[model samples]
Target chain A: MGPPWWQAKFRGCGYRITIAREVILNTLAKTEDHLSAEDIYNHIHTKHPNIGLTTIYRTLDVLTNLGLVYRFDFGDKRARYELAEGPKGAHHHHHLVCTGCNRVVDYTDFIDAEVRLLQEIEQVLSKKYGFKITNHLIQFYGLCSRCQADG
Target chain B: MGPPWWQAKFRGCGYRITIAREVILNTLAKTEDHLSAEDIYNHIHTKHPNIGLTTIYRTLDVLTNLGLVYRFDFGDKRARYELAEGPKGAHHHHHLVCTGCNRVVDYTDFIDAEVRLLQEIEQVLSKKYGFKITNHLIQFYGLCSRCQADG
Candidate 1:
């Protein structure tokens, strides 16, 4: 509608507004699920048949460095990318990855108790290890209902 | 002196034991840190010069499929391996990955409250999403003290 996160970030950083980068970022914005570079290429291949796989990977690298995208590793060989939350935004989402079916569920329902527990953990680690933890990715691997019934 | 996890699992499942598999499992058991397949191969390559990278990967696949080892993707390209907690054991550890320095800290000091919070989250997710939760991996990403200071 107005300006996507990537556009604002690129403008602030003085980076060029290239077509390839725009297309990749737009594809990510439209995705409901976290996607790998291959997945992105496939999604845009019909419309942007000229875009090569290498271009997609390189653009993702640039977007990640610009802090417009967050890359996650879900025990799969490939890395999945999602839009970075806005400035000062809480990275509060957790992923539930089904081990049996490889389906990922993004969980945003953080109860107060769970949030307090994580804050405490961060405080402890910061004091004990002297590390300032900025973000956390928690993934619970399990079987979905269908897989559970099948197993 | 006693049989390790891989040995028992293989024996129970009637799978053949090979030198490559044994070496990889033993290497993982001896380390307190997670290691990639290349790291494992490099550690044992001098003694077992005949072992090929292909063999190491195939053996890891077999061990992983048997539920004898755990595979982790730390937002790095390669997958890291660790021995699975024994049947009666608890793999209650999490990790802190330093984005600036590429350092990984294994955080194992899980308190009762933290454990309880995770249990509650699992229960809530299972009830709402119908997922059969099994295992979890939690990683906090940030700059280490030195990295933060340097930045």
Candidate 2:
């Protein structure tokens, strides 16, 4: 209840917890869908018409750089974002993007086999390339059920 | 060798095999590095000064749409491209990107364990979301050894 964890992070990074940033973060935090800047603007425009699209874009950049948000490009030319740490805690997952309909599914079921594979891959890559591996992104592209049915 | 396989694909898609396209494809095909449109233009500019950057950009869009190239976003804002099919055949691989230097290494050692894990994940995701999975992309981000040493 005390200002939330991310506000402290914002202060720690020399960034003031501005209202625009707060609203943008809250908008992303509420949605399971990966939303474009325009989408975020649309979500809050009615209630907070003072917030401009440019401000949302700039704030999203700040949040992403602060590791408070994750940005993604699903081959759509535009970037989409979601809260990096969701209400479910550190909701780490990858994406399943529908090429047909641009629907995105967050695949959160990181099973044991996945853990082992990533461990092995990181080990091999670190040894081979001398990389200090930190993070990874995986996205699968195909048709969602509704799109397939339409086709 | 006879006009290469991709030319036929272009023709099959009703796209003419233009020289600018050929040069762009050749430039990407020859390199292991993911080249931005500017990088491709830079590589071919001295020899083919007439082929402007606009042509390069336009051709890249066509090639990307035709599925003759794969486009990637390494969080660098610029899109990088590589040939879909290489001289060594379909060179399917993931990337390990150095956040410090923007270095990209193709991780091609797809072991049996990795393959099995992907199959399992695809199957599980397909059942859960009813998605007909097609292709995937994986990218790991971190500091390369040089960057770590420099730090």
lDDT of 1 by residue, A110-140 (tens): 6466667777889889888989888776778
Q: Could you tell me the lDDT of residue A98 within candidate 2? A: 95
Q: Any idea how many clashes model 1 has?
A: 0
lDDT of 1 by residue, B37-75 (tens): 899889999999999999989888888888878887765
Clashing pairs in 2: none
Q: Report the alpha-carbon TM-score of model 2 versus the true structure.
A: 0.86
Relative to the true structure, candidate 2 has a C-alpha RMSD (angstroms) of 2.7
Report the lDDT of model 2 for residue B5: 67
Pick the lDDT winner.
2
Report the number of the highest-DockQ candidate: 2
Give the alpha carbon lDDT tens digit for every residue of B1-151 in model 2. Answer: 4877687778888888888888898888788788999999899999999999999889998988887788888878898998887556545678899999898988787655666778778888988999999877778889999999999
The clash numbers for all candidates, in the given order, read: 0, 0
Q: Write the per-residue lDDT of candidate 2 for residues A1-151, one digit (tens) a residue.
A: 6767787788888898888888888888788788999999999999999999999999998988888788888878899988886456545778899999788888887555576688789988999999999887778888999999999
Off by over 4 Å in 2: A110-112, A149-151, B110-112, B149-151
User: lDDT score, residue B70, model 2?
Assistant: 85
